[model samples]
Target: MKDQIRSLQRLLAALSSRERAALLAARPAVLQQPRPRTLHQLAARLLGTASLSRSALNLGEQQFLEAAVAAADHARGPGLPFVCGRRDLEQLLGVGRGVTADRFAEVLRSLTALTLAWPDGDRVWLHPDATVLFPTALGRSAHGRPPLPAAAPLVVAAPTPEFRPATGDGHGSGAAALHFLDKVLGAFTEPWPALKQGGLSVRDVRRLARILHCPEQESRLWLHLAVTLDLVTERHGRWICTERVPGWLRTPPADRLAYLAVALADVQILPGLPTQDPKLLNQSFATTGPSTHYNAATLRLSANYSAATLRRTVLDVLAELPAGQAADDGPALAAAVHYRAPHLFGPYDPTKPPVPPRPDPYGHWPKPNVAEVTAAVLRETELLALTDRGTLTDLGRAFRRDPGDHAALRAAAEAALPLQEKATILADHTVLVPGTPSPALAELLRDACDLEFRDVRTETHRITPGSVRAYFDQRPGTDPQQLLDALSTRSTTPLPQTVTYLVRDTAARHGHITVAKAGTVLDVRDPVLATELVHHRDLAHLMLRQAGPTVLLSPLQQGPVLEALRAAGYAPNSELKPSAARAADRSEAMYELPQLLLPPPRRRRGPGVAAPGEWLADLSVDEHEPVGELARFIYNRAPSLGANDCNVLATALGAGTTVHVEYRTPARTHASVTVRGPRLDHADRLTSAAGRTPLPLSLSGLQLVLAVPDGRGRPVRGK
Candidate 1:
């Protein structure tokens, strides 16, 4: 006892405090009492010792116990073993089977200390004495018989262990036994039977062995054990698991087995194991060295993923994405996987896994299997169900909607296509320009093509041949055919000669015109012809301001000439025809100058005509009379006007003579003027000096009034 306590203490010391407490608390219930007797033995002893009256003997308790013992004994030999009978026990206990059935549980408890063996769902014998009980009613019954009253009948309990399976072989055992169990149990738990129902092939045992890092022999042995136990049974030539095992195991071992199975089911094997292989499976296990146990024959499984080259791949697939989409899971996964392992291929989202990575020599990160990663990411993030056929969840769809990721997906799709197809697809679907393609676009195209292409063309034609022809006329000496050929060769197609001529004719009219004070250039070459069209009217107006107006010729006729001059609002002696008209009408019949250069108009006289002096006299008496008053007023009020030119004095005094005057100038303050001319001529002299002189000194500057003519003294004009 002392040694036992010491051993327990050592065990306790090795365990964590929590584990120790659990073990200690469970010990009383788990450990059997010394010399424990079976329920039958106890019943027999009690029956002998108890002095029961005839009435008591007939009470049903003894009958119940007897019936229970019989049933238990019968089970011990049996086709189908069970601890108690439903009908027999009920009659003995004088109650329904439901009530008395629980009472028979004592029999099973009694057998616990005796190492009794029975088959689980699988036919493998599970020893009760070696098994641990889970905290459950049945588990309790298996641990000990139910306590009963003196008159109550004794019953047996069912013998079955209830416990969870461990993740690994922590309990020390030999490699041989483990290998045997692995094969037997692994085979029974294979998904082949279930998969076969779905029309999928069951992965081979050797393939599973490779995944589980075990030998082919061991794997086969495990399958045989499974068959013996009935966990797996052969149907035809194919091996399959019994449906019962799945229900028996609380959590299926097949889950782990399936994981391993899938991992190895598709792996590709080389002719010989190489020193350096890119595949993770090619590497040997830490504990198990490389061996022939997994040779070419056994290891010849298809790989789920293909080998890919790694390179510097950008991880931020979502950088430019706008939110929401159904297919965005792939991009979302890529973004997440890339973010987590920028150097690796990540930013992989479990909701949406990226497409499988491709091989690239210049790539910065290792390429991964896009499809596999995408599926894994979706599963990891719970955005998709394992049983679901790669459908994205609502959240996954939303994530896929992001624009940046969408673009990346498009790029990835293009990359997946054949080179020629990819190029065509990019050309049709992308916004990339010929010379200014985005780096991403350029790189993707290059990868798709599998060759280098210039990003931008340097020695390429910019202007189309049509555009050139549209601006220049095809002159007689020019090689129109050669020009057309050059343009056709430079551009995608040649400009039609007819179209070229139209454009050239139109362009020649206004080609010289550019941006001006008016507005943008519309057309230019034939200012007159173009101006006639309203489309170029505004431009024409501007051109006219620069080049003057065009004119047409007419025959020499007084009436027509007069009509033309009058319609133009021209003054007498100021009819200037256009040069064209002037050339046609020689003999000095007409001459033309710009309207800006036209001479001033001549003043009118009486009925027929008037002399200059006579007109001057009339103006002096009527309007010039005020000039004298104004000059007198100026000399009296302000002498500034009289300081220089005396022409004003002559005009004011009604004298038709010239005058010499002198005054102080502003700079030298000394001013002088020699006799110039009459102050008033048929045409006002002031007209020639418009804007040049300080003030007008002629009748043109005055307001004239008519006065009664006096019979004497030069015939006074009316005021």
Candidate 2:
């Protein structure tokens, strides 16, 4: 009894109120069968007791019996209704009593916290006895549906939990940690406060741990690694990632080569920005400014070689010289350096000192052969200099300044009578071999000679052969017979000729085209014809007629026809084509021979009359029209005919009467026939091959000659 009550009290204290009620409701068969025959019996059976009591069982003993009864009752119906609950529940089961609601509530709260649920509402109902136990408010309502049995609370089967090996903090084995850090650093491009935070909080650590599936401590270690690598900087309580880390990590090797090429070319590297040039750290190398030479070399290497080869070339070039020597090498070394580190050489300042010279691994240094190249450079430089220098010498400078003739010989040649005419005039003057003057002295001799005879005005020259002869006769100590000999000596034709020397030197100044105008008439200096025109009356008359009354004869020979015209007495003023004579005695006279000699009056067509087909007929005496009119006139005069149809035949002859035709046979050979037609109707059928369908024919398509027949029966193809 007291023992039972004490046991129940302990059980109630252990369990939640809801759990207790659930246990009491599931009455076992032992509780229901029969109270043991005596107190000793009940005690022994229920509590394994050896003594009996009259008072109620202790709380412990009471709970033991209640649990036993509930188990038995559950056997009759089902097991416990809830897995966990309170003490008063046993009182309602008839096994024990005197439990409080607060205590019961505490039990139920524990059961609920453990996530147990009630099966039924408010009370626990027994199966066979139909006994019901009302629960305290904490155990009254169902919390949720009862959980499945397989998902019921598990007992700790093994004494000790299974051993899990400790993961070492990320000091030595931190590949995953390092990778995580890399990712974190990779995300940031600029300095940010989060990264610089001193240590991770629970949330931060848990987040990193969840991502990595590792311990929080390990995540903290990875972050520390990032700070050490200089990938990120710690400031205040956050991490600030440096910009260079991402650049170094993300840029690929191939992109580096492309960057180098652009840098060498002095072109922009990044979008919308120029590359920066850094001064070389070394001073041993000879420094030359940006050399187009190096730039070109870099371009060629980049284009022709693979990236690896180019990289090797660059490294090799860098290796060949002393550490401080690259500064002196200038753009050459900078170009090589550019191949390896493009981002480092943004603006490519040529004035900067060069990078240290790295030694060549292969011991083979490349030196450009520059002698010929330098020569080419020098040549271009000189040409540019000369262009800037302008022309040399006074005459050349004058030509450069004003660009007129600056050479004595050229000026002399231009001043002379044109060389061709000069030679002719010189020959006529008997100053040189008649036609064999030398080209070298020809111009000079022409300039030396001047016309000796002038008429009263002293402006016009007679230029007669007699005047020339007279001038020669008057020469001091020279006979007329010897004049020719002296003239030959002066001309270029005679070697070592004294007179020739004087002529060559002096004529250069005076040779010019001779112009003579007399009484509204102009004449050219003609040494050949001057004497003939002046001395012969017949020749003068011929000249007037042939050259018109405004005669200007070149003093050269006139052809024989002029002489004949002079003999006929046709003077310069005679009318060439005469007009008709006036009527005699005020009456028209028609004489056939006289009329034949006179031009007929022009005739025009009256209204409605056909226009003249002949162009010559339409002409006003000598006027001309298009040549087509002649062709039309010729086609009108001849008529010939043959056709399968009379309609076509009639069409071939217009009222005026002539037609010409050209036809092609079935064999494709051409043939001609003349046709007379009045209109063009049905001509297509006439021209069609003997058995073929008719095709339209145009007169324009034929090649034909037509003419009217003359009285002699000859084809009058033309008048």
Candidate 3:
């Protein structure tokens, strides 16, 4: 047991000062004891019970340590300097049954790197105090379970509802990305109103859900992504499309999906926000700060892994599974991830037997644990088209290999996307786009119609009088014939009469009730329509006064009056073109928080005491003053140790090399001595060849010099 600590001390002593500092940085508790000036002190601090207990060893590493202790206990001969051979331990742990050679080797490397276990050539010298954390075979054998063999295997069969490869209309993430962008373009055609504080209210979310033709949750995800990518931003407390939208439209489809995937993965919860809100996932970036209605306790434990790490880990797990096989669902994926890395996602009580995680709650997997988080990210991957029908696509494979390789992601995304751009105009006032629509076709449809429903591979647009009137109001005096023509150009079938009549009638009625300056008067050509506005719910707050049968008085500004009428589903035209104002709104510069560049590292001041090199360089040695070669060597060397550093000294001691030392006299300031065949009495002290005098060596100072030997086993005289 004493030898184990001694061996560890020698190994630690072998490290350079920088290496020692780094080790301490990695394990802070190792430095909590009185500042260690010697290797023995550092080793003792590292091997202390507090440090050992807090090591946070992973499952595989813990198992390996337990097996090593068990193996050492059963050793037949020569166990004083206890060391466990790699192969012997592997066999005892049934490596092939549960652990792979690469995995085992990696575990060993980690153990050695932490200094928890020292590498002794082909064997490992376990820290004598490590057993305080691991149970011996005798302890385990009493419970009818020895700790020698490995535990659960890394890969497990995914539970049933068998893995099925996605097969559908040749549509995937690329198609989905295009569809999402198209909806964003249409939804932001008008600036969305913002409440006094907080994100879209439930009513607002439902409205957006109606416009995007998806569930509230899915709609929120889209809005979140749009905000994160800077395609949409708040202006005057209302969300509107940024100037980047045009540039975004010009970006290639695949590149757009890649950009979205990257942004989605990078979304992080703002600090000081309630993470327990299930809606936090949706509004992590949608609003300034998010608050939710769900109880925090209803939410599962905080995620053990970050979104990016969890995403990458999920990708890796899928990549490792057999071709055409997936983890069935998020729980299966979670199980696989936990098996691969138990250190993350842990409730691992050594006192309790290991068991599977409980099934998640019934609805809204609020802020979830590892399993729930995995499931959520999996859905995102599906939306990104990285995974299809529970299997990785070409894009998924490429992304898994190199997420930063934008070129590859684009190419893979291009291949997976469906290219059909034509829509079939039905007689029932609906247009059905069979596959992903081109930007031109999508824009045309959104201009003349409302998105009724959308899916992975299809979209249905419904043309109505209200939609046409709204379009004409945005672009007054723009012939409704032009929009109809554009829609006709993109459609496979001719326009239906219902759509044609709806557009022409809506266009003719769009410009009635023109507002004058400050909207003080309303001149309406239709008395009944003007009368209807006074009773309309959306515009009732306007409080219009009937000055005459066809004229109404308003107290609001021109812009507010027009917005209120439009909100009431009336397309009231402005007296002015308003094109410049609309253009300015569209041209509102994208507001982005400037990225602060890190300042350059400051140059450290030189120590008060000059370094050894500067001191040695300044020394005025007299060349003709009869200084011996050994004395000259000491004069030229650094003030501390030279080439014979701790590593070299450790190697020489391990190889049992004969030595002759040229060292400075301890009692005399300007004197030196040369002794042949001196030996290390202990780790830091040397014994004279006569075995009587002991000299303590200061590793940090130039105290000892070794005699260089020739190939023929004799000391070589220095020139």
Candidate 4:
């Protein structure tokens, strides 16, 4: 510090006497007194020309930040930190009761995600660098925060008899997760025919609903989860499962549940919240019509807001309601969801290409106002059990921290899974599971048996001849009795005699009707399709010729021949011949998960190195040209006036200011000149009292520069 002071002092004293007079006259503005920088200047400096670059903040995020800064500036207390309550933020944003403090938390979460802000309970603390955005807080009054209201003694209140917070079994959601993979596998087996906009049609969802035994709305949610998790993807207008399903099937229930829960914050069923509102599907934004239902389900609060925002909003809402006060299921959280994302449920007329967006087709249709986001939060936290309901089970405040606790999520999924793996073997060669199976077991069972029925509570399967044959075919060299033995181990009762007979009988007759491509002919013997082929119009063009009573020949290639047979009255199935070794490779590679467009994580940058000064200290050269060191000193070591120094010049521009100037004459004599009360302008150049000429002090025909207060603290109205 002393060295810095001495360096500044030396620089100040190096000036010539005459130059000092001129500088003294011009330097009073800076010397008058130290003052805070104006808001405009600070904003320009801190925000920078490319301030928004590399920042993930969307329009909503940016708006939330500005609102928070404004709030911080207003209620700042004397200290290194500034804190604001949830209520203060609401008022600062000029919001109503409809905008719950939780919504404001959505904004804070975004800021926290960026590491720009953090929250403690209801109070928030911003990164020190963020303070530059609010220059008005500089040198603020040394006044502390006013004392908060005294804590009131607790008073016991009578419990309400009517309301009870239902403990979340996650039966619906958990079952959806377990069943979602099944739907994807079904899609993979038979791809979903996609719409022009690449969305599923009503028929597609209805089929899944029927199969999964869920409502169409819940089915759609499951499909969305599949897409969001990248377990299912679209290829050539058809939805197909990815290569990762084989791996996903083996994952534990907790992990699967964690992934499913993660997906909830993914595809927003309703624009408002994530509650199971019975009428939620009726909402406009929750449309299953097309992808345009919600403006874009890609938008989410967690990705946009900071963890701090979530914590603050949650704490504030709970505190305001009182301890143990339950707000579940209904409109209790409608206000908060509305405030957080007002445009969420609003009408969204997507800009369909080839059609101008100025006038909208669904203009008359009102937007969907989702009151479910809060419900989803309540569901996510599993916290309503803490509020009003004494019957509530313990689910620690998971949302009060990072990305949410996977432990709680895992527990929910495990608890929902049926523990009884035993099955009842029926006399008719069918199996009935008393309860739902975990995804892993379900997948294993699916490999050996054909699923007959599945609902929220039960699952049924049958070991048909075809399923037994398929099980053996996939395993390649397994004995019929071996699979039967495994089945016998799982069944509470003995395996039925008919089932074993069918399995043995099917294995004996499996290869009896072999169809293989022959030279210049597609041949099938003992199939009895010969008479049908001869009379079939589509087969007529294939030039089919009867080689024997049971066999027919066609000149068409294998693919075309198969197509023609199917075009006629035949059900042709393709089996990969050993000659095609690549088929097995393709089957193995097909299950890999599809990648999605997820954003990158937040980035942290270290402070940058200071740049060298632009001005040279001195320039001299000798005839021998040994001036390299001199040049280096002059250009590299020299210091230039910067931000702090600019303040000195600004001080001289004060109104009614006066300064004495020292300038070189045309004759080059060391003579002193006086310019009275010259105004220093924005460019850091001197403005003449006459208001016509501008002077660049260091370069305005002056050999040296120096400044000291002259007629200090004075401002000239005009010359």
Candidate whose TM-score is highest: 3
Model 1 lDDT, residue 247, Cα? 42
- Per-prediction TM-score, please? 0.14, 0.13, 0.46, 0.40
Q: In model 3, where do residues sit more than 4 Å from their true spots?
A: 1-58, 62-123, 126-170, 191-198, 269-304, 348-368, 421-433, 437-719
TM-score quality measure for candidate 4: 0.40
Of the candidates numbered 3 and 4, which has the greater lDDT value? 3
**lDDT, residue 616, candidate 3:** 23
Please report the TM-score between candidate 3 and the true structure. 0.46
lDDT of 1 by residue, 1-719 (tens): 11111222233234443542343242232211111012221111111122222122211223333344444334344222234444444454444433444443333322221212211222212121111211121212333544322232432322111222222211111122323343445544544532223211224544656654555534443443344345566565345667756443332222222222222212222211121223543433211111212321222212222211111111123222223212234444444334323322323344653443333486232334333444333332221111112223222232244413433333322221112111122211221223322234333333222222322121111233343443243232344444444333323333445534543454455335543243222233455643353333322222223323332222333333433444545332323466544553454344366577668888644333333223212221112122444454433332222211122443523533333233222332222333233243344332111222333333312211111122331323211
What is the C-alpha lDDT profile of model 4 across 401-481, one tens digit per residue?
A: 323677765664555455445688787877888676555455557777888886545778987877877887686656777
Residues forming the 10-long window of minimal summed lDDT in candidate 3: 617-626
- What tens digits encode model 3's per-residue C-alpha lDDT throughout 428-512? 8888988766656766676667888876678889887777877887787898789888778877888788778877887777788
Using lDDT as the measure, which candidate wins? Answer: 3
What is the C-alpha local distance difference test score of each model? 0.31, 0.30, 0.58, 0.47
The CA-based lDDT of model 1 is what? 0.31
lDDT of 2 at 347: 33
